[model samples]
Target: MKYLLVREDDEGEDELWGRCANVEGLFVDPVPPPREVLTFRGCTPAGPLREAVSRPGESTALLGNGYVEASDDTQVDWWELVDAVVLAHHPSRSDPSLVDVVVGAGVKGAGGGGFRRSGPSRFELFVGNNVSAGQSLRVDGLLAPRQDPAKIPMELIGCEPTGRLLSALRRPRKREGDWAELWALDRTGQVMAHPAVGLGIDGTRPSVLGGTLIDITLTDGGDDRPAPAARPVWEAWYQGVPTVPNQWAPYSSQGRSAWLRLALHARRPRRPDRSGGVHHLDGRFVTDVPGLHCAMSEALAGPGGYFGWGWDAFRDCLCGGFGLTPPFTLIWHDADIARQAPADAVSACEGLLSYAEEIVQVLEDVGVTVVLA
Candidate 1:
C-alpha cells in the first residue's frame, strides 16, 4: 500500500527532504536544509532526489499544514491543512513506513488526518482561493509569496511551461496590455506553434457571445532575432471558431519563433481584448471569400483549394493555443450567401479566393508570412 503523510507544523527539524513528480512528497518550510543527512524509502530515491532524514518517525520532526476546523465547532480537520513537507536529518537510507495494513488488533493514526507514509511518488495539484480563468497559478504564488509559504508553485510541468517557470522563479508581472506568454516544445525539440491559451467564455457575463484576442509578434527566423517591440501581425478570437496550428514553418530554425495564433483569426467579436490587427472569421456567413460554404462539402474540393488553408489547419490555426475541433464534412444551411441556388455555394466559395488573397496582403504588410499553407 502506498500513501502520503500530512502532519501538523512543528518546525522542529533540521535536515534535507526530496520532492518530485513520480518522486513523492512536498516541501513547506520557508528555509531549506543547507546540508544534512537523508534517508531513502519505499522505492530507491535516485538522481535529483536529494534525500536526508534517514529514518521515519526517528528523524527530526517536520511541520505539517493545519487550519481552524470551525468557529462554532472548535475542531480540526486534516483536509483543511495546507499542503507541504518538513525536513530533518536521518542516519539510514530507507523509505518511510508510509504503507501499513491493519490487523485484527491494530490501527494507524486512528483519529488523525495524517495519511499513511508514502510508498511511492505521486503528483499533487494546487489551486488558490482567488485564482481565476486567465491567471496562471504560478503567477499567483510568486506575487503573493507568504500566501504560498509552502512553495507549492515550484512544481509545474506542461508543454510550454516557460511563463510558469518564470512566474515561479522570477515572479515577473504584467503592467497594462502585456500578457506574460508561455512557450512549449515537442518531443523532437521543435517549438510548439501554439504558445498560450485561456478559456473562451466566462459564465458571469451572461448573454456573452464571444472572447478576447491575444497579442503576438512576427520575427525573422533566427535565434538572436527579436520580435518587433511595436505590434503583432494578427489577434485571433478565443471562441466560436476553429483552433489548431495551420502550419509549422519547416523553414524556421530553433532560434526564431512564429507566433502563429498571435496573428491568426477566430469567430468571436464581443470586443477586442488585446490591441492588434483583428482578422475576423465570420462563422455564420461567408462574406469575403467566394467558394467556402459555412460548412465543409465536396464543393470545397475544387475551386476553394487556392484560398483554402487546409480545412483542419485553418481551424487549428484559428483556435490558437486552445484545443481545436477536428475537421468534419460540411453541413449546409438552407439560405446561401449567393442566394441563387444550392449549387452556387461551391463556386461562390472559389470567388472568396480573391478576398483571401487581399487579406493575405494585409498580413504580409505586417511582416507575417501568409504562405498558401
Candidate 2:
C-alpha cells in the first residue's frame, strides 16, 4: 500500500516512502558492497519501518541501516524517516497514511482547523482536532499534497445550523455571463420560471427578468469611481367594472363599428323605472363625415331637432342640443370609418381619434362609462 509521508514540523522537506530494494539503505553492509541495497526511500526494508523491528534478520539489518539513528542527538526514527520521504512525493489527500497523519495531528475533520491572517491575501492555519464552526484549520504540514479549495471534499463535514461551515466551503455564485450561457443552453424555459428568478428581481434589471442576470456599470466621469446604482420601474393593472369584451380590431371599419355600438350602450344611463327609452343609432353603413352627419340627424331628429356634421356642431349637439337629453344613449355603430379614413384623409382620421378621446372623456365626466372594447 502507498503511504503519504508528512513532516512533523515546517523545518524539513516531505517525501514519499515505499517498499523497494533500490533505495539507499535497509540491509546491513556486506563484506563486499552489493550492487544495490534493498531499501525504500533512503532506508531499507522497502516497507513499513515498524515491521522491521518484529522481523529477526530485518531488525539487525535495519539497526545498521544508515537512515535510522538510535542516538538521542538526531531523535530520528525509522518511521519518521519513512514519513518524510512519503510526504516529499506529494501523495493524494485521501491516502490512508496521509489521513492518519492529519487526524493524529489533532485535526478534527478534513477542513476543520484554526486560521490566522498571514498576509493581505493569504492566511495561516494551526490545523488540529476539535475545530468549531466558523473556525479555519491548517492542514498544510499534515497532508502530502496541499489541497486547493476547489478540489477539497467539503461535503465530508456535515452542515452546521448557522451555515457558516458550508458558506466557508462553497464557491461564489456564477457571474452574469456564465448564467446567461447556461440559460441559453437550457432550451426549455423552465429555468426562467424558477422562483429564485422572481426573488432576484429586486436586484435585477427589467430587461433581464425571465432571463439571466446582467452586470451593469455606471461612471460619473471621475478617477475615484463609485459603485453603480439603478432605479427600477414598477407597473400596475386595475380591473374596473366589467362591461363589454375587451377585444377590438382597430384597423377594420366593421370592428370599429361594433366597438362603438357596445361603448354607447355600456355608458347609457339606467332610468329609475327601467324603461326602454335609451336612443341607439346603428351607423355601420355610414362611411364618411357627411354620411355620419346624415345618419345622426335622422336618428336624433325629434320635434325641432337639427344636427350638424362639423366638430363644433357635433360638440354643441352633445352638450344638449338636437332634442337629445342627458341620461340618453346613442349607439353609433361603424363610427370607426372616420378613424380609418383614406390615405388622403390621414389628417381627418387623426382628428377623429382625438375627437373621440375628448368626447369619451367629457361623457365620462358626466357619469357616462364608455367601454371601447
> Per-residue lDDT for 178-258 in model 2, tens only?
110111001221111100011011121222222332222111111111111100000000121122222222123333332
**Each model's Cα RMSD:** 25.6, 39.3
Which candidate achieves the best lDDT against the true structure? 2
Displacement of the residue 215 alpha carbon in candidate 1, Å: 23
Q: Give the TM-score of candidate 2.
A: 0.22
Q: Report residue 21 deviation for candidate 1 (angstroms).
A: 47
List candidate 2 stretches off by more than 4 Å. Answer: 1-276, 302-305, 343-373
**Count of backbone clashes, every candidate in sequence:** 35, 27
Q: What is the TM-score of each candidate against the true structure?
A: 0.17, 0.22
Query: Which runs of model 1 end up more than 4 angstroms from their true locations?
Result: 1-92, 95-250, 253-257, 264-373
Candidate 1 per-residue lDDT, tens place, 62-110, comes to 2222221111123322222232232333222233433111101111111
- The top-ranked prediction according to TM-score is 2
* lDDT comparing candidate 2 with the true structure: 0.27
